[model samples]
Target: MGHQQTVSTTFTSAVGERIGASLALVDAELARRYPGDPGTRQPVHTVYVPADAFDAATVRSWGEGALAALDRHAPDAASFAAVLGIPDRLAGPVYDRVRAKLRREPVEDLRIDFEDGYGLRPDAEEDAAAARAAQLVARACAEGTAPPWTGIRMKCMEAAVRDRGVRTLDVFLTGLLEAGGLPEGLVLTLPKVSYPEQVAAMVHLAEEFEKARGLDGGRIRFEVQIETTQSILGADGRATVARLIEAGQGRVTSLHYGTFDYSAACGVSAAHQSADHPAADHAKAVMQVAAAGTGVRLCDGSTNVLPVGPRERVHAAWRLHHGLVRRALARAYYQGWDMHPGQLPTRYAAVYAFYREGLEEAAGRLAAYAGGGGGAVLDEPATARALSGYLLRGLDCGALDAEEVAALTGLDRAALDRLAGRTAPQD
Candidate 1:
């Protein structure tokens, strides 16, 4: 039906094959270095408790405390919405969901802190605390009372505390092994990491532990806490974060930003030290890029402002915390650190409002894209992936109901999972 071409093609299949062969090494390297997201349900926030202070009742107590705060201050949807400026359309739903989430799962990811929160205790006291932490965590996991994710934060790999940190981790892991096998949601955090060697050291520790326990390799994964300037930028003037991730050797699950420590490391005045500071932004931005496509999630730091004291003071703190959380969500930092239970209300409120505000539009666009029907906005596959991911996250956090998401997007959970590049669950 068409006219024949007059000229012969200059390139052939052989030429393309040669080019592919030449780039095979690069393809393999890319696959190794940037494996993309792991497609797991990342927790919305990580709550840190002192190793000695954590107990079976800690999770429930936090939930009760958060509920009490809601009752005392913003007792209803309208009042809570007024404090956080939630829209009328979203107020009741967000308020109801926030309360339900507090009652159901107040803390998603919990870290038993032996670092800053625990401070430097005597060797004996720290040892006892570490053992006790393992016992409580194992028991909680067995009783189905633990948060979905729970872990310990050992001290840094710095020379001063290197052996002590290793010893504490050993004791903790040994305790867990003795009690039973390690739980599936067990996490480890190595804080104040300033060099790639520290990450390597963590890997080594994990490997040695696995070998000694005869456990599977790569079974233990930890988070690298980026708190020092050196962790972001090396003395050789390169993005040290990339090297840190590399040194992790496929064992780093996430990178957590430390607000005050990082700001203070940058010489930020105590009064000016906040998560929104320019310095913190730069650190987190670099973290985001370094973590992108690397299967490592990013967590923003916590705001030290606690919603305690008089009702007026609590309201002000709630407003501040809510604004900060919303800002972080806008920047695509889905997870953060929550220092106190008081911040839980505003945290959920901001997260819910963010998803709810954009829900209709996102759902419409995704539905159109999935159905191959044109929409106002031309969306690429990547955008579809993000949109599906957004809705799935909302659904997972209870901000969006599964039925409503299915109705809005015209795609069920399995369809969403496929679009988001996650493996659908087996029937």
Candidate 2:
């Protein structure tokens, strides 16, 4: 019989206790600042319409316009695929889905813009528009015709327009409250944020609004538009975007990249200013890093290249927009801005094709990991989380069917949610 060998322990439980106590503040900070994903359906794109131009028929008009563009430009699947260079395998399905999506839900997120899109307007005119916007949005919500997410982009917190911005927001909110309560999908955007103090002010403004309205403290969430270079890199040389997130006080739902403004701030020439410019990429890279694990999403800027004019010109523009969108998806920036109704077709096409092309492989990898079976690709827990998230997003955007995902992965929504770390941990 062999004698059992015993291993001696070097450290006592007190050592671990000491280490844990020393890092208590760090633990708390991590929990507070990096709370992880919120497990909600993030819209795939934000369509901006000038507040003065938006009305009850705006959404339906956009859909009709996009569909009309499709009918006139690429009436058939083959032609549409050829225009956008979609592979033969995915051309038909992607085309069909794009048309259906345009008809069913063309605009995922609609923003009634009072900022750049609206430009500078007279005070009375702007106030009336703001109040009218609220009434229209409330009516849409009540009629069940509102998009899944709908909101307004008020003027920035700049000193010149600060008071106007505040009054507009107050008027908008008050009008909503008077018309009815705030809609469930309501969002507010603060653009041209150049300092952390501005974000803090926004938080205070939201708090004051909530208190006055007798609403919950954290009820109002908004997106911070990273337009100026100062918003990305501060005078102190730190990552200003990260500081801005901290200043948001848990009310920042997303950080929206401003393509033209950011590029112009970087001094890119007008001819070369585009979403895929190196400067834009660098800014977005910093944004992605800072927003990681913060439960805050990142939105890529839009391309100004609208698909219109002659057939060849429209095709060229569609290809450009499609390529940029695909590139954005590959970089994990799932949401972007659509400036025109004509861009909607290419947007949905790119999104659907991207998810569909990778669906089989992603499903297989996830299924293997979930089933605890060895596969060609040995994925870690982190990769498993990403795989599940990709599938969930695909499902959310109507790119992938839940039934098909279940059939392939043998894991339903609940199982996928658990794997994606979207469910709260059980003690």
Candidate 3:
């Protein structure tokens, strides 16, 4: 016993420090700044209007007008149900709630575009428009009629027009903050970013604006638009999503894919610049992978086809928009751009149908997994996470309510919250 020698199996101090450093790097890589719960009202699409055309009242009216058009286009609940292929029982309720939503707050995220939509207006005119927008935003904010998310899409900072872009941003922000204060849920959209420096510059400007406005450090958030090949694949032949996010300094809220612009960058024909185009898909895939687990939202571009004019043409356009929306949903991009009021109906129709059709199955799987038994079917941890996310998204979108999900999934509010927070599970 006295001759027995002690042996040490513990790691040396240097080796332990190296392991700690490796883990620290991994944690940093997986770090995320979530935008947090968007509350009960999450808009499925953002409707962009030219800067000159934007006003709170007019925007609300646009939504009402869109609802009226949808009503005329699909007169009865039965016809609407047939068009969207939802259960007849849900037809009237879905139509009613959708109309009510549109009437009350037609546009969720309204982007007052000064870039492509507004073009190069006269300086004086643009100044006037900017002031008017700020005034309307203030008014809407005071009245509580402001959409949950609202912002201006400034022109990009390319060398040729960087001055004008900064000028427009300064004027708009100055007026907005002066009119009371920053609107609740205000965000900026930086379009056609070609390099990481562009994002860094935008983030810097946001910091400056926040300081001037007396807002918090991260209050002035922005979403970047991936419109060019360079935006997806940097000049160095590597993906640029992570770089752009880093350059935003944790203030980036979402990444919007510009289908037409990206396709054009790839030299694709005008006839084939749709969201489902291969080039667009590749860009979106790169975006998803880079932004995964980062809480950065993704928005697909709009369908160029507008549902107007003759009945046949309108119907055809509706079919096209609906098809594209379905494809986006399949790809897990819940939000897209709605170019016209008419597209509103199809947007909701497709969204409601997508969630509705899979409700029961998703519910069963989630309930089984959450119950710990998992007796219904084998579920990997990732699959469990996906099921929970699907239900949570539906709940956020108002497609499914707390009580409904609870009844289907046997999960109460607290359990659902826990499920949402279940990023990892010990095996």
Candidate 4:
């Protein structure tokens, strides 16, 4: 028995040493990934610009301006991707304006009406513009010089999938796909989504597109726009929302809350509803909880109706309010989405704060544990709890991986053996 105990401890100690060496090496490699300094995290925001907001020169300026602001504020972000949503009619001219200036991938969302018959095929002008936008997207993806994330947002309807059913949607998506419409890294945004079946239908179309092109249709992603009356009231307070999400496992990439449409659906006056209102918080919480640790990013809805201007107060407060909304989502542990160029600084700030808090926490716990001395039995339940919490936070945020726990906290891999109430401090 004594010999076995000796062998086991020796093995664990040797393995812990190797793990520490490996972690040190990985830290060096992670530095190369620009994992950012101590005060940094990924600031991902979905950028939205109104169709009428900018002309050609104005559009280029906006794209460039967003880049500059992101660079200035959230330099540590892994990447930035935008979603441009507007009527199909305006996309071409808008694309012409912003295409040259954007450094990162900018997605395009075609505001289509699926409720109408056979889907509204655009008139000549709109068709031409959509075609041009499509061409631009293909050019960007195929050529060496285009943006990193090229995508599309098509429409969805309950009548088609529910009462009238999704046959109409199938036809519309087929046309979009056939027209050389879908782009690489394409994101199909489903508005008025009520169930997983709707998502399944979209996924089916993506597979068809893939087979046709000999590409991995499985790569197509969905961003559920939890808009419309159905999604907000929890689709008539259904008990199966969690099931709906599970059914959509392969399809969903993120969840987006549309406050304007959501408010209208819920029939609350605009005055009574704010983005951070308890109601909105409840709605967003449902999504954040649903998406937590599932790898699907959660995007908060837009603040809506902000003026692009020189005044710092309006922009400042706007950023601050949105930052609060974002922090709420972060506290719930969602990584990112939805911001204008001016709000870029807040996006970075929130992410930085998120990691900074964790890093500070981990450093504190490690220090205390080290000071406790090897084999120390001091049991301040409160301070001991902090060590477990620190380990979890680091694991959650990717600061310290699972293997590092053995070395850092001296915890073993088995359940119930976690070093929660005990530790062996370094000499």
Model 3 clash tally, residue pairs: 0
Span of ten consecutive residues with least summed lDDT in model 4: 34-43
For each candidate, C-alpha RMSD in Å? 1.7, 2.2, 4.8, 13.9
Off by over 4 Å in 2: 1-6, 424-427
Instruction: Find the candidate with the highest lDDT and give its number.
Output: 2
Q: Which residue pairs in candidate 3 have backbone atoms (N, alpha carbon, C) closer than 3 angstroms, thus clashing?
A: none
Q: What is the lDDT of residue 87 in candidate 3?
A: 81
lDDT by residue for model 4 over 87-195, one digit each (tens)?
A: 2433333333223224333322222223221234444433443444455545544653433343334446456344222433344335446666555445456666776
Question: Model 1 off-target regions past 4 Å?
Answer: 1-8, 424-427
Candidate 4: pairs in clash:
46-338, 159-165, 160-165, 160-166, 161-165, 161-166
TM-score of 2: 0.97
Clashes of each: 0, 0, 0, 6
Local accuracy of candidate 2 as per-residue lDDT tens digits, 1-427: 6999899999999999999999999999999999898888889999999998999999999999999999999999999999989999999999999999999999989999999999999999999999999999999999999999999999988999999999999999999989989988998999999999999999999999999889998999899999999998998887799999999989999999999999999999999999999999999999999999999999999999888899889889999999999999999999999989999999999999999999999999999998899699999999999999999999999999999999999999989888888865311
Estimate the TM-score for candidate 1. Answer: 0.97
Judge candidate 2 at residue 270 and give its lDDT. 96
TM-score of each: 0.97, 0.97, 0.90, 0.57
Candidate lDDT (C-alpha), each: 0.93, 0.94, 0.80, 0.48
1 or 3: which has the higher TM-score?
A: 1
